[model samples]
Target: MVKDVFTNVVANLVTALIFGVSAYIILYIRMSGITQTIRRVIHPKQRVFALHDLKINGINRLEVSKFLSPLSEHERDILVKFHAARNGSNPHNGSSIRLDGISPVSNDKKEYTAHISKVGFFDFIATNLTAYPANAPIRSFRSQMATLMRSFRTFGLIQQVVNEVHKYGEPKKVEDVLENRSLANIISVSVLIVDATGRIGIVERTNKVAVSSGNFGATCAGTVGDVDFDADNPFESCGLREIKEELNLDLERLHFDGIVVPKQKMQPIFLYHASIDQTWEELFPIMEQARDISFETQAFYAVPVEDIIKFASHTRMTDTAAYQVWQYAVKNGQDNNWYKTLLLPFDVKRYLIPWNSQKDGTK
Candidate 1:
């Protein structure tokens, strides 16, 4: 009887071990799937922000590819109208381009006189007083037209055009909209949180602090500040300032991953990332010794790509800006895994490391 009992106990233990491992593998893969979904959403925005950031750090080839995909239905339509209007195909359908100081009119008529006047956007002044009639082709007219087109696109002419006529564009008082400048004060600082895979940084919290937080629930966050001018571009300067203040991280060594800005927001944020390969012995010492080592108040924690979707699905993440960041992370994470499977079959390595990990190398 004793021998039979021992044999049964051993068999049960072996079965338990197999079941535990199987459960872990299933859970891990499910988490990974969730992560991929997050990345796919985040990737496009990051790519765009990176392109706009002339001095952006840490951009890689995969991110570049995602950004170059075909424009969405709405974006394609807007682009078509914008391009056509600027080219004079249907310029008369919208507001005068003259407001942007880029009059599409050329001095092809030799007898026409030229006059200069400074006008604000949407304000046009036609000079009734002609200075001179010239036989020589006036270069200023063509130059002005080119300048205007550039300004129109740069200053978001497409939005203005669409807004002027759309029901959604009904003349809005600043008080009536959440997009009013007043909301700016609440989120005075903008942070472009990012991850190691060039994905937008995200975080999940059941606490109310996240709900009341300025823009998003993200672990690695940096506020946009004007304190320094190390880089000529705003995005680059902001990125550097944020890393220094928030993480006490030196941007010089971090690899440039990509920049991401969600299309829905007015003031864009740029995302950047770098890979860390050192063991805990070489890693924790440096991080621990950093100037601002505390994470208690900030609620800062790096999220792996595998857990992105779960983080994003929280009900408390209702802030539009925060939601955009979450969505961006999930989409881009998946897109990366999808392509990796096709390009390199056997190498299923995770390149992303969360900012917070135990001293002994556990999360």
Candidate 2:
């Protein structure tokens, strides 16, 4: 009887050990998946496309419509709490544009019709707050809020919040919404200013800004607000407005370049290139007197076209700014030796889609 009891105890110990090991393995796998999902949402690869490759017709090119995507009760409460904690009152909730879909017009995949809808600024903030990881060092309000909400079990909570947002109104995955262009909560414009001397203008963002604070970004950028809808060229109008507001400089030649959709937030950035007759030295004084300089820009750097790649290597640039530089280099430096360096150290080719084979867009 003694021997039988001892054997039974040994068998129970072995069973418990096996069960514990199995449960640990299961939990680790689940946690690993959650981590990957969160990382993908936080740090997504960017896609860059040229203008001519896309067939954007006159007024019909971008069709805007009214869209009503209200936040859930939980999301509304979270927003309220965040505002109360951060600003002690609700901030300006202006109307912004949201990308609804991009319909492919042809089998060649070169042409697409872009569709957008109007969404409130609050909705934009709520949906896109999870784009940053909890530990992101950026001092922006959104990043801080994300950190506050997901400090505990960061990855799991991020995944849960993303899932909830995705399922709130539409049954879709966060990746699908961002990557597939199913729904982009916000659409903004970024402008690259090139001087007559072939120098690119770069700006350092101030902490007062809502996004990408303390980071280098495009010369000027702003959301495509509701006011742009009435303009003759809404996209260009938005770009020019940002230029006037941020740089206090006007250009007669503002060219629409293309669009870049970054995976991080899946925000569509309408890219513009403006040429100024003045050299960097001549333009500095005017920029200093910009109306919103104290609130928007910390400093401005005039980087030579040839050295942009090297500058990008050293500076912490916003994703849209990096792509804008890359696109500019590809457009002007293809035959130059500096273009080859873009392939070696940075390898931006991995991110930029191949230029349309028919450069002239001729069949």
Candidate 3:
């Protein structure tokens, strides 16, 4: 009897081990492949899954001219109509500024910086999406996972890999969001929020959060999205995403890359310029619908650029990067008084990083 019991126990243990290992392997593959990740996103019981569209391109392929070439006449017409209907004005025709060439590491000596290869930013997801198609988020998804998959975001594979390496270590698994081997470290967009008054929108970060919390900074900011990755003006789409997520407000017109600055070990800040044409009292009700995705904001304030400089003079109340952009826009707007309202037909030449010298002054 004792012998028989020992054999049965061994068999059960082996069966359990096989099942556990096989489950992990399947989960691993599903996480890495875009098509395979559907299982995690479809169920109602699952945690919220953000679908990120990582518009990863190698450094060599990111030619400013190619990305900024004039839109086809039809696309241009569509964009014009789209902006007119939504933004109430036509954006300036001009060159675009990009910080794509900036290095993420502060002291790394490499002349060029691209995504870390191990995580797979270079690998392409076989998605059928083309640059900016006129479509909205897929809301038909009945499940949380479906919602995430349709949310339309792209994450850098390199950052995703470094952040998830530890999850693959042991067989014992607790499912963390990053452990999926898909989600990556984040990049962000900072919009110099403003209104018709030409006032810069600022927010006080909650003291409890990480990084620049409690500091006065751009309240309108977030990661770049999937559609904007390959569009004629992708930066503005990202600006819209941050606005929708934080304030639930989607202003029609936006100017991309009002400023681009790379900080130490940080992705260059893409400061897209957008001015909302509304009063603070009118804005309060609109802001109430906001999801406040990051929970980082304490309050909102709209102050004129000159006032901000004066406030900073005494107390350093400005997000320094955003401050520089205010100066840039003011100067670029010049005698036309366009900067005061952040009107369209924005001057792209003024905003480019000093290294990228593109001379097609008007888009």
Q: Which model is ahead, 1 or 3, in terms of TM-score? A: 3
How good is model 1 by TM-score?
A: 0.34
Model 2: per-residue Cα lDDT over 1-363, one tens digit each: 999999999999999999978865554443223333233222212333323455433333245443343346465446534533433234467888775656667788666656666766666554565543211142354644453454343444345556655553542332245343323367788998888888888887775665556667788999988888666666788888888888788765477776665544546678888888787677666766678876887667777777776555445666667767766776886333433443465432222211122234541
Cα-based lDDT at residue 350, candidate 3: 27
TM-score of each: 0.34, 0.66, 0.40
* Model 3 C-alpha lDDT versus the unseen true structure: 0.40
Q: What clash count does candidate 2 reach?
A: 0
Off by over 4 Å in 3: 1-186, 225-234, 262-265, 315-322, 325-363
Per-residue alpha-carbon lDDT of candidate 3 for residues 249-292, written as tens digits (9 for 90 to 100):
87776654422322211233445566667855467656756787
Off by over 4 Å in 2: 1-52, 58-70, 80-91, 104-113, 131-161, 164-184, 334-363
Question: Using lDDT as the measure, what is the rank order of every candidate, best first?
Answer: 2, 3, 1
Q: Which candidate is the best by TM-score?
A: 2
